[model samples]
Target: MRFSNYFIPTIKEVPNDAIVKSHILMIRAGMIRQLTAGVYSYLPLGFRVFNKIINIVREEMNSIGGVEFQLPGLSPNELWMESGRYEIYGDDIFKLKNREMVLAPTHEEIFTTIAKANLNSYKSLPQIWYQIHTKFRNEARPRAGVLRTREFTMKDAYSFDKDWEGLDVSYEKHAHAYRNIFFRCGLKFFSVKAHSGAMGGKDSEEFMVEAEAGEDSVLLTEDRTYASNIEVAVSYREPVGRKNSNLSFEKFSTPNIKSIDELADFLKITDKSRLAKSRVFVNVKTNEDGTKTNEYILALVCGDDEVNESKLTVLFGLGLRPAHNEELPEITGADAGSIGPIGIKNPNVKIIADQTLKEADELVSGANENDFHIRNIDLTRDVNNIEYYDIRTAKDGETIPGTDKKLREAKAIEIGHIFKLGLHFSQKLGAYFLDKDGKENPIVMGSYGIGVQRLAASYIEQNNDENGIIWEGEISPFHIHLICVNPKIESTKIFSDKLYDELGKKGYEILYDDREDIRPGFKFKDADLIGLPVQVIVGEKNLNEGKIEFKLRRTGERFLIPENELIVLLNNYKYLFGFK
Candidate 1:
C-alpha cells in the first residue's frame, strides 16, 4: 500500500467530545469517521485492521470445527415471539415495519429456529455454528465510539448438543478457542464470571481488559487470582462479632437521622459496627396474565457498604430496582427515610440483610415512623422475618473469598463472553433432537462472543501513550511501515521500493510512504498514529550509509541494519508479533 494514495488522515488535536483514549485516537488517526451517534464508517486503514482481526477469529474458530454461515440481520418478529423474548426484551430490540419486523441484537433465536427445522436425532448431537455479521440494538445512550455502538459487527457462535455433558464439552471448546483468539491478538485480558443479564442463562463468563474509561467495573483480589465483574464478584470478611445479649432495645428521638453518615455522627461512634443501613427495593415481575406485581424488598447492609444488585438478582432469581415513590407507601407502610424491617406487617414485603448485619447484637435502625429512630436495637429481638447473606460490595481492606489476599477494584471493558446456556434457548424455542433411546429432548446450548471492534478500542485504551496509539504487534493494522524521508531522491526511492518488495516477498505487509511533499516530521507523526508494528526508515543519509534504521513501535527501540539485511531483520521479528 502506498501512503500517498491512501486515505490516511492524521489530526494533531483530539476531538472535544471524545472522552476515551481509543475514541479520540481513532478519530484523530483517520481510521474511522462517525456517521451518527453510535454509528461509524471505517476508512481504508481501519477496515484493514478490522479484516485482519476477523481473519484471526475465523482461523481460530475453524480450527475447532466451527462451520461459518451468513445469518440475516433482519429477522421476523414471529421468530422472536415464539422464543418468548419479544416481551422480555422490551425496547432494547429494534422493531421495524410498523412493529412487524425486528433487527437481531443476537442470533441465538434465529440459529435455534434454523436448527429445529433441519437438525433432528442424536447423530447431530453436537454442532458449532457461527457468523460474523452486523447486529443492532436501540442503545438508550451510545457513547465512546465503537465500544458502545447501536449497530456493529459481532462474532456470535452457538453450540447445539443433546445433553448437559455434551453442552459442557462444547462450551469448554469455545472457551479454549476464545483464549487462543485473544492471546494471538495480544490483548491483556482476564476471564471473569458474568451475569447472563438479558441473555438468560444459568452460567456465563466475560473476558475483560482493564481500562479507566471502561463502562464495567471489575473486582479483583490483591493477588489477581480471583477476578470478576463487580456485578457478580463475592467479597469475604470474618463474620461480624456479636455484641452482648443483654443490650436493651430502646427508641431514641433523633431528628433528621436519615443517612448512615448522619446517624454515625449523631451517635459519636467511630466504628460503623454501631449502625445498620436499610435500602428499599421493588421486585418487578410479569405474571402469565400480563399483569405486573411490585414486591417491596427491604435490603439491609452494613453502614460502610453499598448494595450490589447483580448479586441480589442472582440470589432471588428475579429482577429488582430501587423502590419508586408511588409504590413505597403500599409496600413499606411508611416514608422512605423512616421505613424499617422491625414490626412490619406487610405480607407482600421481604427483608434481607448481609451476614455481617445479622451478627450485630445492638445497633441503630429506622423507627418505622417519621422523625424518630431506634437505638440499642438487637437483631434477634427487634427484627423478624429476615434472611441473611452477603449482598454488598467489599471494602478496600476486606479479604477475598477463598484467599488471604485483600480485595482491590478497577474499571474494565468486557470484550468477550462465554456462557453455559444449558437448554435456556432450546427449551423456549422448541429446538429439540431425538436421543439414542428414541425420546425427544431439548437440545442443550452454549453461546460465546468476541467483540472484534471493541478489542481494537481496548488495545488503544491500555497501550496508548502521549503520542498516539501503540498497537500490540499481533493486531496492529500493518506489519511494517516503510518511510521514504525524501521520496524525490532517486536513491531514497529506490531503497524504499526495494525494501517494500523484499518485505512483501517475505510475507510482511508493508505500508510504503511514497509522497514527496510531506515533511519527515509529518511522516513520522502519521506512522505513530497508524501504529504499525515496525518502522523501516529509508532516508537519503541512511541510503548513503548502505543501512536503514529499524524502529519498533512498542518498545521505541531503534537499530541500524544494512540495506541488504532488511528482510532477515523483519523475518526474525515476525514471530514476536504473532505472525508464525
Candidate 2:
C-alpha cells in the first residue's frame, strides 16, 4: 500500500470533540470518520485494522467448529413476537416499517427460528453457528467515538443442544475460544460474572478491558483474583455485633418523616444500625396476550444502603419499578412513608431484606401508618414472613463478597460477553428437538459475542501514548511501515524501492510512504500517528552509509542496520513482537 495512492490522511492536530486518546488518535490518523452520532465509516487505514481483527476472530471461531452464516440485518417482527422479546426489548431495539419489518439489534430470534426449521432430532444434538455482521441499535446518546456506535459490527455466535450436558460442552468450548481470541489480539482483559440483562439468561460472563475511559464498573479484589460486574459481585461483611437489647417495640407519631434521611435526623440517632428503610415496587407481569398483570413488591434495606435493582431482579425473577399510589395500601397495608415488615401479614406479597439487618437486634422502622414510626424493633421477633440476603449496593472501601480482599474499583470497556442462556431463549422461542424417548425438549442455548470495532477502539485506548496508537502487533493495521525520509533523493528512493519490492516478494504487507514532496519530520510524525509495529526508515545519510534505520513503534527503539541484513533483522524483530 503506497502512501501516494493510499488514503492515509494523517493529521497533526487533535479534534476538539475527541475526548479519549483513541478517539483523538483515530481521527488524526485518518482511520475513521463519523457519519452521524454513534455511527462511523472506516476509511482505508481503519478498514485494514478492522479486517485483521475480524480475521483473527474468524480463525479462532473456525478452529472450534463454528460454522459461519450471514443472518439478515432486517428481520420479521413476527419472529420476535414468537420469542416474546418484541415487547420486552422496547426502544433499544431498532424497529422499522417496510410495513412490519424490524432491524435486528441481535440475531437470537432469527437464529433460533432457523434452527427450529432445520434441526428436528436428537442426532443433531449440538451445533455452533456464527456470523460477522453489522448490528443496529438506536442508542439515545452514542458517544466516545466507535466505542458506543449506533451501527457497529459484531461477531455473534449461538450454540444449540438437545440436553443440559451438551449445552455445557458448547458453552465451555466458546468460553475457551473467546479467551484465546482476546489473548491473541493482545488485549488485557478479564472475564467477570455479568448480568444477563435484557437478554434473559440464567448466567453470563463479560470480557472487559481495564481502562479509565471505560463505561462499565468492575469490582476487583485485593489479591486481584476475584472480579465481577458490580451488578453480580457479592459483598461480605461481618454481621452487626449487638445483643438483643430487650427494649419493647413502640410506635410514635412523627409528622412529615417521609425519607430515611429526614427520619434519621428527627430520631437524633447517628448510628445507622438502629434504622431500617422500606422501599415499595410494582412488578408488572405480562399476560399471554401482552396485557398487564401488576403485582406489588415491598423491599427492605439497611438505612445506609441503596437497593441494587440488578440484584433485586435476580432474587425475585421479575423486573421492578416503584410502587404506585393506588396499589400501595392494598399491598403493604400502609402508605408509602410508613410501610414496614412488622405485623403486616400479606402472603400474596413477598418481602426481602439485606443480610446485614438480620444481626441488628433493636432497630427503628415504619409503623405501617402515615406519619408514625416504631422503635426498638427486633426483626426476627416482629416480622414473620421475611427472607434475608445481601441485596445492598456495595459502597467504597467495603469488603468484597466471597473473598478476603477489599474491593478496588477500575473503569472498563466491555469487549466481549459469553452467556449461559440455558432455556431462556429456547423455551421462549419454542426451539425444541425430539429426544430418544420421542418427547420434545427445548434446546439449551448459549450466546457469545465480540464487539468487532469496540475492541479496536479499546486496544487503542489502553495502548496509545503521546505520539498515537501503539497497536498490538498481532492486530495492528500494517505489519511493516516503509518510510522514505527523502523520496526525491535518488539514493533514498533507490533504497526504499528495492526494500519495498523485496519485502513485497517476501509477503510483508507494507505501507510504503513514497511521497516525494513530504518532509522527514512530516513523515516521522505521520508514522508515529499511524502506529505500525515495525518502521523501516530509508534516509539519505543511512543509505549513503549502505545502511537503514529500523525502529519499533511500541518501544521507540531505533538502530542502524546494513541494507544486506535488513530482512533478517526485520524478521527477528517480528518474531520478538509475537508476529509471524
Candidate 3:
C-alpha cells in the first residue's frame, strides 16, 4: 500500500470532541471518521485492521467447529415476541417501520428460529453456529469512540446441545476460542463472572480489559479467584450491629431531614447501620394478551448501601425502572426519599428488603408522614409483605465472602462474553430436538459474542502512547511502515521503492510512504501516528552508511541494520512485536 494513494488523510491536530486516547489517536491517524454520534466510517487503514481482527476471530471459531452463517441485521418483531424479549429490551431496541421490525441487537432469537426449523434430532446436537455481522442498539449515551456504539460489528455464536453437560462442553470450547482470539489481537484482558442482563443466560463470563474510559465496573479479589461485573458482584458486608436502647415505636419530629445523611446529622448519630433507606420502583410486565401492568415495589437497604437495580431486576425476573417522584406520593403517601414499608398505606405493593437488613433490629426509617421518622423498628417483626434478597451494590474494601481479603474495584471495557444460555430461547421459541429416548426436549444453548470493533479499540486502549496506536504485530494493518525520509531525492526514492518491492516479494505487508509532496517530519509523525509494529526509515544519511534506521512502535527502540540484513532482522523481529 502506498501512502500517497491510500486514503489515510492523517490529521496533525486532534478533534476537539475526542475524549479518550484511542478516539483521539484513531482520528489523528485517519483510521476512522465520525459520521454522527456513535456512528463512524472506517477509512481504508482502519478497515484493514478491522478485517484482520475479523479473520482472526473467524479462524478461532472455525477451529472450534463453528459453522459461519450470515444472519440478517434486521429481524421481524415476531421473532423477538416469540422469544419474549420485545418488551424486555424496551427502548433500547431500534424499532423500524411502525414497529413491525427491529434492528438486531443480538441474534439469539434468530438463531434459535433457525435451529427450530432445521435441527430436529439429537444427532444435530453440539452444533456451533456463528456470524460476523453488524448489530444495532439504540444507546442512550454512546461514547468512548467504538467502545460503546449504537451500530457496530459483532462476532456472535450460538451453540445447540442436547443437555446441560453438552452445553457445558460447548461453552468451554467457546471460552477457549475467546482466550485465543483476544490474545492474538494483543489485548490484555481477564475473564470474570458477569450478569447476562437482557441476554437471559447463566454461567456468563465477560472478557474485560482495564481502561479509564471503560463503561463497566469489575470487582476482583486479591487472589483473583473470584471476579464479577459490579451488577452481579458479591461481597462480605459486615452484619448490621445496633442496640435498641429501650426505644420502641418512637416517632421523632424530624423537620426536612429526608436523606440518611441529613437525618443522621440532625439526630447527632454517626452510625448509619440503624438507618433504613427506602426506594420505590415500578416493575412493568407485559402479559400474553399484550396488556401491561405495573407493580409498585418498596425496597429497603441499609442507609450505607445503595440498591443495585440490575440485581433487583434479575431477582424479580421482570423489567423495572425507578418510580417517578410524583408517583411515590400516591403510593406511599409520602414525598421523595421518605417512603417506608412499615404500616404502608398501599396494601397491593410488594415490599422487599436487602438480606443485610434481615437480622438487623431497631432500625430508623421514614414514618410515611411529612417531617417524621420512626425508631426501634425491626425488619423481621415490623415489615410485612417483605422478601429478603441481596440487592445492595457491592463496594470496594468489602470483605470477600469466605475470605478475609477485601474486594478491589476497577473500570474495564468488556470485549467478549460467553453465556450458558441453557434453554431460555429454545423453550420460548420451541426449538426442540428429539433425544435417543424419543422424548422431545428444548435444545440447551450457549451464546458467545465478541465486539470486533470494540476489541480493536480496546487494543488501542491497552497498547497506545502519546504518539499514536501501537498495534500488535499479528493484528496490524501492515507489518512494516516503510518511510522514504527524502522522497524528493532520487537515490532515496529508488532505494525505498526497491526495498518495498523486495519486502512485498518476501511475503510482507508493507505500507510505503512514497509521497513526494510531504516532508520528512510530517512523514515521521504520520508513521508514529499510524503505529505500525515496525518502521523502516530509508534516509540519505542512512543510505550512505549502507544501513536503514529501524524503529519499533511499541518500545521506541531503534537500531541501524545493514540494508542487506534487513530481511533477516525483520523476519525475526515481527515475532517480538505482538503477544508472546
* Positional deviation of residue 66's Cα in model 1 after best superposition, in angstroms: 1.2
lDDT of 1 at 504: 82
Clashes of 2: 0
- Give the top-scoring candidate (lDDT): 3
Q: What is the lDDT of residue 120 in candidate 3?
A: 98
What root-mean-square deviation over C-alphas does model 1 reach?
1.9
- Per-residue error for 505 in candidate 2, Å, reads 2.1
Q: Write the per-residue lDDT of candidate 2 for residues 1-580, one digit (tens) a residue.
A: 8999999787887788889878888899999988888989999998888888899999999999999999999988888888777877778788885558788999988899888887888898689999999999988889898899899999999999887788788888988899988888889888888888865676688999998779988887756687788887777766654576788889998898987888888988776655788887777877899798776666778788787878878766665777777767777677877877675535566777888877566778887777888987777777666788878777657786564568877789999998877887778877889999999988888888999889999899888889988865678877788999988898888878988999989878789999988888989999988888889999988788888899988899999989899888877877534565
What C-alpha lDDT, on a 0 to 100 scale, does residue 332 get in candidate 3?
A: 87
Residue 180 shift from truth in candidate 1, angstroms: 0.5
Q: How would you encode candidate 3's per-residue C-alpha lDDT over 274-350 as one tens digit per residue?
A: 78999988888889997989888888889899999989889766568899988887888888656777766678989
Which candidate order results from sorting by TM-score in descending order? 1, 3, 2
User: Which pairs of residues have clashing backbones in candidate 3?
Assistant: none
RMSD of each: 1.9, 2.8, 2.1
Clashes of each: 0, 0, 0
